[model samples]
Target: MRSDVQQQIISIIAREAVLEPEDVQPSMTLDELGLDSLGLVEMIFAIEEAFDISVPFNANEPAQSEFDISSVGAIIGAVERLICGQRPEIVA
Candidate 1:
């Protein structure tokens, strides 16, 4: 995994979610971080802006499932896949 990318994502989430760095675990879900739907949307947009990439949003396909975005690690993985132009797997 890309440690720098992971760290950048963790920093963004921690700052935006108002959570401690240690609290941002790899397996912790976004809901667990207290981010609602709007927060999630904002987070995604922030990520896109930060990385200068577009995250494909397909209404029919549901690019990312709720379960897939549960943790800092998962979120980083998703971003990496997006930057690489690959769809993320919905893995919990």
Candidate 2:
């Protein structure tokens, strides 16, 4: 379920950043979650590892023009899309 994904993401972020679970929020920005670029990369890796899917990284395109993976919900949505083999909606 969606809650499972949320929990998984929270766990990954907490583990990586050494933060408490209560600190992470569904609407919180990655920066608010205390995740820098390296932390974001680790989060992506954790999501991929947990879901057994590879998240496509289009470095040539702007992030906003790709998937807006700026929050927990967006990250979970992206993972779901990848697992379903569908393209995520690119948010500008």
Candidate 3:
């Protein structure tokens, strides 16, 4: 059973990808969805708005950022952790 947050996140990403939510899988990477830098940024913004949580993601150097957006599952886990009061480890 997927949580509401997970479903919403899938919806947001799927909307951006112009695909169906079912097409978005947890193991899939953002790159696999053909999400460019702008798309990734937009997804991040949508997620922040949906969860009302601050994501420490820097678009320019995402790999070094505290927030993880490498894969759909990663984003889901990160959001869940964040909403549950687990702060992202500040990389910088």
Candidate 4:
């Protein structure tokens, strides 16, 4: 069962990907969802608005960013951490 936050995130990602929410899986990556750079940015914006939290994401250098965008599950975990006032580990 998905938590409210998970469901909301899935919906946001689904909207950005033009897919049904059910089709968005936790294991799926943004690339697998066919999200280009612009789509990724938009999704991030949606996430920020939904959670009312600032996401430490650098669209230009996502790989080096502290927030993980490696997969849907990772994104959810990052958001959860932020919501709890915890910063994600700094990626070196």
Strongest candidate by lDDT:
4
Tell me the lDDT of candidate 1: 0.70
CA-only RMSD, every prediction: 6.0, 5.7, 5.2, 5.3
lDDT of 2 by residue, 1-92 (tens): 34655677678877777788777777877777777777777877787787776777643452744556767778767666676674233211
Better of 1 and 2 by TM-score: 2
Q: What ordering of candidates by TM-score runs from best to worst? A: 4, 3, 2, 1
Tell me the TM-score of model 3.
0.88
Q: Which pairs of residues collide in candidate 4?
A: none
Between candidates 1 and 2, the lDDT winner = 1
Candidate 1 per-residue lDDT, tens place, 1-92, comes to 43666777887888678887667888887778998666777777788787877766532344455324757777787787776664233221
Candidate 3 C-alpha lDDT tens digits along 1-92: 78777899899999988889999999999989989998988988998887778888899998898888879999988888787774333211
In model 2, which runs have C-alpha deviations exceeding 4 angstroms? 58-65, 86-92
lDDT of 3 at 60: 99
Candidate 2 similarity to native, TM-score: 0.73
TM-score, every prediction: 0.72, 0.73, 0.88, 0.90
Model 1: pairs clashing at backbone N, Cα or C within 3 Å: 29-70
